[model samples]
Target: MEIAVVTGGVAEIERDAGQGSSMEAEWLALLAALRLARRQGLADFVLLGDAAAVVAQANGAVRAPGAMAAHLSAFFVLASDGPAPRVRHIKRTQNLAGIALARGR
Candidate 1:
């Protein structure tokens, strides 16, 4: 999975070994991004990605099912433990930088 943290319009890319579907990778990336932001002393952040389902789950629109349920639960706990976080979905073309990084993975 590839995660990009955009703080002040500048982005830093990070990657992890992705398992399962694209949505899973996106969810994992969201978790990782939030953790990274907290480590950087960020008190509030927004996560932008191209995965619709994952974004929906993060935004509490859809239920996280199967293996993702645990991750989703963990996401909420970690998020509330520190900074305020927002997750958003964007078009793949608009997320080209992350797309390239994910493809390389």
Candidate 2:
């Protein structure tokens, strides 16, 4: 699993294959991004990612699967008990930069 948190063009990334599933990783990454932003005193932020299921769950547009339900719940708690850092899903083609960064290429 690889996660990137970008703010002002500066990106902070974390990778953990130790985590079981991609959905879990996405949820964890989203939670970590929000926590990082809040700890850095960043407000009114936007979170972009390539995971549609995770985005929908985070945005309350759909229910999270059992594997990621708890992870999503945790994100909501950190996001002021609701959505924060507005999440948007992008096409994988449009996410080349993030993919390259994640691959360290």
- In model 1, the clashing pairs are none
Model 1 segments beyond 4 Å from truth? 1-18, 100-105
Model 2 score (lDDT): 0.75
RMSD of each: 2.8, 2.5
lDDT tens digits, residues 48-69, model 1?
8788888888889999899889
lDDT values for all models: 0.75, 0.75
| Residue 26, candidate 1: C-alpha displacement in angstroms | 0.9
Per-residue accuracy of model 2 over 1-105 as CA lDDT, tens digit each = 776666666667776536567677777777877887788787677777788998999999999878788887788788884445698999876664366565684
How many steric clashes between backbone atoms does each model show? 0, 0
TM-score for candidate 1, residues paired by index: 0.77
